[model samples]
Target: MKKYLIPLLAISLIWGCKKEVKKADESKEIMTTEDEGWTYLFDGKSFDGWHTYLQDTISSQWQIEDGVMFYKPDPDKNQGMNNLITDKTYKNYELSLDWKISVDGNSGVFYGVLEDKKFVVPYMTAPEIQIRDYTNIPDFTDKQQMSGAIFGIVGIEKDVANKAGEWNHFLIRIDHDKNQGSVILNDQEVAKFPVNGEAWEALVENSKFKDWEGFGITQNGHIGLQDHAHGVWFRNIKIKEL
Candidate 1:
């Protein structure tokens, strides 16, 4: 009876080990399925797929710490307005990211950014979605310039961003195939506009970009993070190409 008891215990232990392995494999399979068709723009370790606009290397101001891409402001650096941009160009995709800004700080996410020797900055050709400390900035009254607005081109329906220091999530979908562009802030639809065609032109024409040639013209371009000389952090940046 004792010998049989020992064998039964050993058999039970073997079954438990098998169950554990099965659970692990099932978790991995679920994770893989969830991640399918999505590409991470920032790997959370280093800036491998990004660089400074018009430059081959990223500036010292950009740092990867605590799994976040942080813009460490250094007033004495005198680096000018050098933005970080994706090395590859994307035409139609859904981009998701998280951002946080310091008090009274301002920055922007630019899409369809054309990088050229003639163009000094990305804003010359890209359409920006404003990222600012809206709740804290006393003078920021314009809805068109508020966080999640297509900066000056299109305004948000409502302010859905968290306060200055809190993390806000932005899910931007730019699909020229459907001729529609939209911004989802903090899981709410904040802004939507035409991606191209006459309506897009009219929006740009009424804005300050009216005189800026090639502004929002190209369908394929790079995504950019503006350097407004304020402390900003970005994380969980990923994209799904359509």
Candidate 2:
């Protein structure tokens, strides 16, 4: 009886040790630090941390469908109809997303947006990376208005936007410490401009955003998307703090 009991205890101890080892191995796989600095603002699943620019709730025009944040047109809505904004504020960071527009569609990705209800247009408070279907949108006169442009402030010399209905990638980096901002489209550097430098001041002075106090101020604010009264889809929205 003693001999049998001794063997059973040894077997149990060995099994316990094996289980512990297995747990350790599993934890190594599950606990990863790959996304430590990156925060997934959108995972193509839900609009959990986003809302309209100044409103607490999301607008009916903005919809999450087929794993994309899309804007559906509504003729009755006002100028600021289709804007959506991030719930949290970010100071300096790198943001990335992909966008595709319908025929003749127009949209924009904006940053440094101040959440003031008094600001009628989102562009007044934030600088934008323009997105539009250049080929189909006849009124899209400026190459800077094509895609990856800093909207009215800066322009891309060449067209980098994919054809309408196809996805185009955008990467925007803002460094508040250096007061610099840069944009990349399809892995190519399209625009690089200083935030508070003479060039930026000139841009602000000439543009309609001049009068706004918070215009082009990159201290800390929410990211925004323009509605533009057309169908547009955005996905894979992610950001990393710098």
Candidate 3:
């Protein structure tokens, strides 16, 4: 009886160790393949590497609800500059996300954001991908001010933005090596412009951001979302450096 018990215990221990080893191996394999170069800015659960621009912590205007990055503003507490930004900056990368804006709302996805104390808003130092509800937002009347535009630098050639309140996709690519960048909305290529050189300089010179000192000057900076004091949801946020 003692011999049989010892054998069974040994078998159980060996089986347990084998299972643990298998799990570790599986985890390593998945990590290597699935998430090797892709960085999830929003991890679908928490705001791990995100914070308000120039601030150490996230503001009340931004919240992670369920698995989505939600913007729920307080009219009474609204300072109008509580934009959310990434902790780390990237030089050249592919950024993708899904966003839905409230009717008549306004927002933006900004990159190359220089969070300087001299600037009160991210747009002052960063180029923006305008996020607006085209259904009712009347303040911006230019095609360059609509969704997926290089916000004022160039207009979106294609009108691919979905109606407000419906989730829309955005894929923004920056390749400084080729001196080209693109904006794709709803899987359709809508805008392409020279990211550098004389063409880029001319566009900047004529746009609203022309007077801004640091706007589009740096190649690497944080990515951020404009808190336009309205309801907007952003999720499935991720980036892959190019």
Residue 156 local lDDT, model 1: 79
Please provide, for model 1 over 91-110, each residue's C-alpha lDDT reduced to its tens digit, 9 standing for 90 to 100. 99999999999887889999
User: Which ranges in model 1 have alpha carbons more than 4 Å from their true place?
Assistant: none
TM-score of each: 0.95, 0.81, 0.83
Q: Give the CA lDDT, 0 to 100, for residue 65 in model 2.
A: 79
Error of 3 at 168 (Å): 0.7
lDDT of 3 by residue, 108-171 (tens): 9998888889888897888889888866544546889788998888997667778888999999
lDDT of each: 0.90, 0.83, 0.86
The local lDDT score (0 to 100) that residue 208 gets in candidate 2 is: 69
Candidate 2 overall lDDT versus native: 0.83
Give stretches of model 3 more than 4 Å off.
1-36, 137-141
lDDT of 3 at 90: 84
> What clash count does candidate 1 reach?
0
**Model 2 stretches astray by more than 4 angstroms:** 1-36, 76-79, 137-141
TM-score of candidate 2 relative to the true fold: 0.81
- Tell me, by lDDT, which candidate is best: 1
